[model samples]
Target: MEARLSKETVLKLSTDHKFGAEGNISTHKVEFIVDSDFGIPGAVTVVNGYDNEFFLESITIEQNFHFACKSWVQPKKLDPEKRIFFFNKAYLPCETPNGVKELRERDLMQLRGDGRGRRVCSDRVYDYDVYNDLGDPIMGDAYARPTLGGQHNPYPTRCRTGRPPSTTDSKTESRPSESELIYVPRDEELEDTKQETIDQGKLMAILRNIMPAIIDKIMGNEEVFDIDHYIKESGQSEFNSQLPLSRILLNLGGAVQEFFKFDPPKTYSRRRSHFLLDDEFGRQVLSAFPLSIESLKVFPPVSKLDPSIYGSVESALKEEHIIGHLEGMSIQQALEENKLFILDYHDVYLPFLERINGLEKRKAYATTTIFFLTKMGTLNPIAIQLALPTGNPNTSSKQVLTPPKDDTSKWLWQLGKAHLLHPHMRYTLKTNAISRQTLINAEGTIETDYTPGRYCMQFTSAAYKDWWRFDMEGIPADLVRRGLAVPDATEPHGIRLLIEDYPFAADGLLIWSSIEKLVRTYVNHYYKNSNAVSSDNELQCWYREFINLGHPDHENATWWPKLANPEDLISMLTTVIWTVSAQHAVLNFGQYPYGGYVPIRPPLIRKLIPKEEDPEYSDFVKDPQRYFLSSLPSLFQATKFMAVINIGSAHSPDEEYIGGRNDVTSWVGEPEIIDAFNQFSMEMKSIEMEIKRRNADPKLRNRCGVDVIPYDLLIPSSGRGATGRGVPNSVTA
Candidate 1:
């Protein structure tokens, strides 16, 4: 058999040979000829490496290659040493998180999140149509999708050649092609695990495992997907009401998925997630949910929602109501004390409401939820105001929904919180996904999601534009931006949070500090001082291109500080590393745990709160439970979305969690740098236990509320499948 090894293979001998000496062992030898063009060895001659009695048969070789683990300085071409390691337990074909053994190829055809999926879109790269978005600031005069010339559109086919393939020749018109039944890529092509096959087999697998169980145990053909369904009997606590949440956190939940990826509620009959969404504890716990509430900030916001127009919801969030929750603290006092924090979605959704509401069975409000930090350090929801842009950007109508004084009001408050989080789930994933190649592999999700038409990109772009705060991808910097913390020069990381019990921030700080220390050590090892940082041409050039070319729009933005000091370099490098590993895990891996349940955390909510004048009002009043279900995605739509998030939440067999795996024995780096990373690994090891302790602590209600489940999203390690924990080192989903 004729066999060939192009490059990237090696078989070494234990005995050492002198520099430039031929490989020799008695009568045996091994020789390799280097490829001149690429400077890589291609031909190897293992000439009788064994005894003369043992004949040399054919020499076989295989090499696994992967894209470099993304640091800010990712290699443009393949670099073997920097390659991310992945496992292909193809033997365990059914071993998928959420039990989705195979994927829905037709449904998820263009939605794959890896190099293989990118290859699928290689031909029908056009999106079946053009989006001449007149308001696109990047293009100045928009005439194309990002795939043509937008963000993360690596191939600018239009720019390279003045025209792209006709928009008419895309999507359905181009005609779909069949895909292989199984994901049978070469041994080297293991990275394409998520979406090589082109059918709904994975979706079918997920539905068969988890989706039907919901109907069988709770809903029982009720035709509704509501948290209330979790409760099996009257007055039963939500804690013991259902087991699927565990099945989701366990069976269906991903054990330790690499890349990508909600809570809370009302009513005893409806089932409550006290740890996730209690009116007082769970709602505030969600402030640190890490999905949509990253927008939470000290209220009255540093800037008003709809600041461009006459945007103010201050009237709706009354001082009396807020002060009632703040004990003796006045609104102004809480603001000064950092006791008041707001997750305001008003400014973001208002501009696009008119267009978004027009989409079929879809409607949303620009919402603002206010939470007051209690004496015990848990956040308590004071007021939630839902607003609608009154057809004018300048004016919006707002109505406040407070903690339930009655039953109608209880579900209303629940509805408000649900809507607050629902709209931003995909956006949060997309924004973070776009933050790093590692944040979320949810690359094509925005386009391929269930949202109607161009509105998906429009909504996502609005979120990105609104959320583009000038902060490093660090929780400390984010907290500072959100006014959740003050910059304290004396604090270890140079910042201290106002709310000490904050789960995501508190747990994240340890991870963040460890990472920063590692970066400082790594950068300081090479550059002795500011002079070195400034003088390094390669470093300076990389930074220049990173800004000028990578984010050209913000190249000259005020936040782009001069890279002249080692400390500055440390900050830059740490941001890159954290964004890829821990930060991305916090954002990505927990999708199925929270979103998998679907009741407490719906991806989208369709109807607005009904009034007497509305026709749906009578129906809502008659059967609020069924009305709410009607507002949610139908069973099929909801289950299909479940499958999407489930797929995003699972890990491939060969997973690389945040700590480099045991197999990664060495890297080409300074001894001190390796030591720093090892230190980081040690610190990361302690994090899971620390988090477990906090969850065990009765004082932290947000984490260990009325349920046995605690916030494990920040847990640094996860097993295979959807385990609701672990931070993958790379974007696996």
Candidate 2:
């Protein structure tokens, strides 16, 4: 066998010899010659060394030679016999890349040799008509049914060059020749043809089987080929109630998927979410529930005891653990009144007051929260009464506006409409304790709901401000004279609770609601103007300006120096909102009686129980007032951490929760979120100090109903009370 090596192969060999073990061990190597054209060794010679011990030298050289051949030995042209044999041998069968063996005849047909190559005999062996007698090539299956295009006809004929083929030409017709014509049909064939008549039923059935597919293809495979056809054919209009809300949502989601891709652009968001604004859906949900008083009647207070409180003051506040016990007898009375007391909002009033003020902003914030929580199924029948100012101040009492007939009706009113108050009224809205208690009673719901039941709400402007104030005639006569029995201060006014005291406070929810509104504002604005916001910087800039961060007229804003970098500020703000919302959730729905019940003992009687003393300490355990007052510092600390979280998750949009998931599936209040909160808390030393110093001031603490002990200690350090293990004691120093 003759074998040829490529230039690379020879070079490789030389490279191996020069660089391998053979090169190292050998001593006969003399010179290396590389071909200038091919870059390979042209010649190599290894001569024996004169003083070699035993090895002989190797010499390799390239040489070329040619000899004249005798005249008679060479042929002038290819011999027929020799050329034929050689051609046959050279054209031997071989496997093609397609794995098919190539035939000699087929291979020969593909080649031409200057019109001098011998024609293979087998090329003409297969005698078939390539053209008709008229010399035009026959095309397709001429034996099948005739077609207008001659390409499909079995027979073919050349057309006259001067003009198109005439219909009058017998050759142009598809009729078969005399020999090919059928004269009579066989009995079986006749019967078969007779039975082949088209059946309407079968044709319709076949069409029904294939029509959908044909329509789908025509419609680009859309699920709904025709909306009217689908609705009418499927009887969808009559089966509306048969579909579950979840199924509807899923269907809506599917429709949304069809239009807007779930895959967000290569931006920060992991997934796109659709948020339905408060509208008919909100109303429908509210309409499904009973009115506040009625709901209270139907869904009675749970018999379960309060959650046991444990952890340090900071941890307790941050963790939202229970602290002290409420006097059972008095609790029963308050429960009868359907009044649930909330201490956090009332005791730590400064932060909220600083963050949110003014009737308009407060109304917007409160309304937004109510609607949001209502959607979350946390609050129930919410009654909001806004008195539209009538031009005539002397309008009859009968003409005065009243609270909505029910929450569903309240839902019918728009936010702007709900903010309008009677000119004579002083407050935004007036809600009774029954509705507030409804919220407290529904704390440990399985659904993870945050909405409270029906509450009386009123929207007013300044007419009755003094009546609702904490000083002078405005103070609730019962609260000042009987509730606390504290002597009226000589001075008229300095600082006081803005509203008359209720049996319970929804301050956490109130503040949380504000945060919730702010969060929604940002998120909604982000989505609404998502197209305009192409980058993180743009989004932050848009939000800052939109929220009116530094504007003097803006009510909802940061009090401290604003972060110069909008991106940082937006991120921190998002984190704050997410963290606060989650924490508020933990406060409201994560446990039963998150802060324990209000004390039943009168203030005078509770004071009688010595501060440092014994068995009676159980009766005098820390109240919500003390718990909230002490937690002010920790609350501020938590706030700072929230800022940290915002900053951390700024660039990564997927890190923060959008409004897609409901309460149960939401990322809020999760352990990871809490961990993030804890991580940032340690960095807020100054904020915590300021909080502590302010809360510790004797005058302020006294005036604000603050306690002497630290917020961490629910029970007196000197004595034991009704203590039960609850939260893991993971308190930060």
Candidate 3:
């Protein structure tokens, strides 16, 4: 005589009514009795789940007739008019008995009559009507049907069970008012959106050719480079007629190099440069770059451990045990002490630890260009080498200059180290606006002038926690001699994409001093303020308002609320900035304008028509900006899909898990969370389908000699999915 609610029933009810503290509807177990004459259920009492409020109002006879119920208790309290509506929709386990007699006879079930009340009562009465009869009795499965004017449901709805198929004509079907259909996107509107996207793609292709050429021309010169020169140069060239000024500077800087190129001293050899090109120097440069220890070859490597080992949260919690030394300290307090410890940790302890751990020696590159004022003149040496750093500068390597092997040279070197190590030295250097690039050569003599030579180096920003630190106010001579010191020319952490610093290099490139400013100005507005219909709409607004900033209406606009909170906003923007800058660093750090591609790959070249026949094909270029914007939806969509998978797997006990801590399903086990995740998946899938439909036109495919449909470029190609090279079976097919 007992029945359980199906999972489908719970999910639908939860979604439709809303749950938790914010929900509009509440559940109640109501007592009712079946009328012998009408074979209909009449409500006796209804109790609300939230406040235990009882409602005993009489229900209409017509509603009872519509419900076609025998004596039973309603699962939850509802309006007297909607009692039948709720009863018709709820699903019950099929094992329950029938009729009012069975409902009253349930006392046949044993009970601990005198025992303390159980925390949870499974015996609460509920009668789920599986059949709804309007004319004649008919059976229904799940979900109660409402009249045509009833509230719309998100679930897949069906017609009333006993009702015959509507004989309504096309005119009747078309009679619904515009407000009833307002949420649906019209076919014409969808088509226009599709066309707009294609137009953006077309415009991007044209700019691709124009933008990169502008960067190359500017970086190749020794003189001050200007975008105006290129604008004039482009006017004479018929192909560059419509190139936009704002578009060309999308890389943040109008040019890739920091300033007009300062050619490495001609005597420097390309092949034998032990400077920044050497293994040691490369390591030092990477050290200054913003990255976590996990990214930079962490200890107790993940590859060596079994996946099962990471399946539990214990392992993740254990990793944080290293911070146990500051058990009761506040985050700000820990940070202050951590900063001091980090300076020594990176310079001395890190090297010592690596040595003891049998790790290879890492090269140290000069952060600032070293200048030596000799009797000959001022010479800017790209790098310097250490000689007997612990005792005195006079004792060692032939590569480093040791004048007269006397106290004068040693004393002068020490004085220079002390001057360079002064905490505020970088502030003065910024005012001078000097810039230099990493040089890869071992040929030049390591040289520096003691008579106030310019050695400007910016420290890494504070956002790196304590990872990229320096002994700013300490004796550099001893540290350098020990091969544990970095040059003053080094840029701060997170400045990998120096393009942002180009416009304000003389202002000391302090734009990244606080991520909050950027988040408040750029990230927040796009996420929150704009009324975008989709991710495309949001991204377009972002580019127009923040990145371009050339649009007049957005000049004074403040705030965007794309994400839920400040934490999420910070996390998202941090990822975007770090991703963009890291790639830019790879290109501009050593060889300027090499690799010429944006970090994230753009959407595949769209072939809208035959290459030779299409008029726009001649000007068709690859616009990375458009492609980058387009690709963002895929990331968000994929994240949703992955969450859905995790949620689905969480419900299955048979599913094999990789690691204790690594299993996302373990972390996201709530039923509500799973339902929310599925809803997002449905939305994203709908958007993906729309995109597919737009791209499905035959003309979009390359239809030359051998027609080939383009593979989905937005999806990542994994080695695990490759056929020949450790690719998975899914990708190979």
Top of the candidates by lDDT: 1
Tens digit per residue, CA lDDT, model 1, 540-599: 866885665545545557877678999888877767666767676766667766655555
By lDDT, is 2 or 3 better?
3
| Native-referenced Cα lDDT, model 1 | 0.52
* Winner by TM-score: 1
Residue-level lDDT of model 3, residues 1-733, one tens digit each, is 2332211211123333433232233434333333344333312222234322222222323333223222222234321222221222111223222533333233322211222232122222211111111111122211112221111211111111121222332111111122321111111012223234334433433443344345445653222222212121222322332558675554335343322211222112223212212222222222222121111122111222122421211111112322333345533453333210111112222112212222111112111112211121111222222211122222211122222234443332222222112111111111111111010001100001011111111011112112312211111221232222333555453223211111111111221222224344434433343232133333344444332232222223343234445444554454333223322222122121111111111111111111336564333324322322222212222222222211211111111111111122321323443344344335433433433453354432211112221222111111111111110101001
lDDT (Cα, tens digit) per residue for candidate 2, span 1-733: 1122223211112322432223354533223343454332212212212221112222222322111111111111221111110111111122122211222233334332232322221111111111112211123232211122123222211111111222334343232232341111111011111122212222432433244445545654213221112111122223233689988777666553333211111111111111112232222222111111111211112212112211111111110111112123333343344322221111112112222232221211111111112212222212222121222334311111122344332222322122211010101011111111121111211101111101001111111211222111112222243222233354232122221221111122222233334444444433334333334443455455433422212223243224444333443454444333332222222111111110110000101111235553343243422322221212212222222222211111111122212122122224443343333333233323433454355443211222121221111011111111111111100
Q: Which candidate, 1 or 2, would have the higher TM-score against the true structure?
A: 1
Q: Per-model C-alpha lDDT, please?
A: 0.52, 0.23, 0.23
lDDT of 1 at 306: 46
TM-scores for all candidates: the values are 0.67, 0.17, 0.18
lDDT of 2 at 667: 24
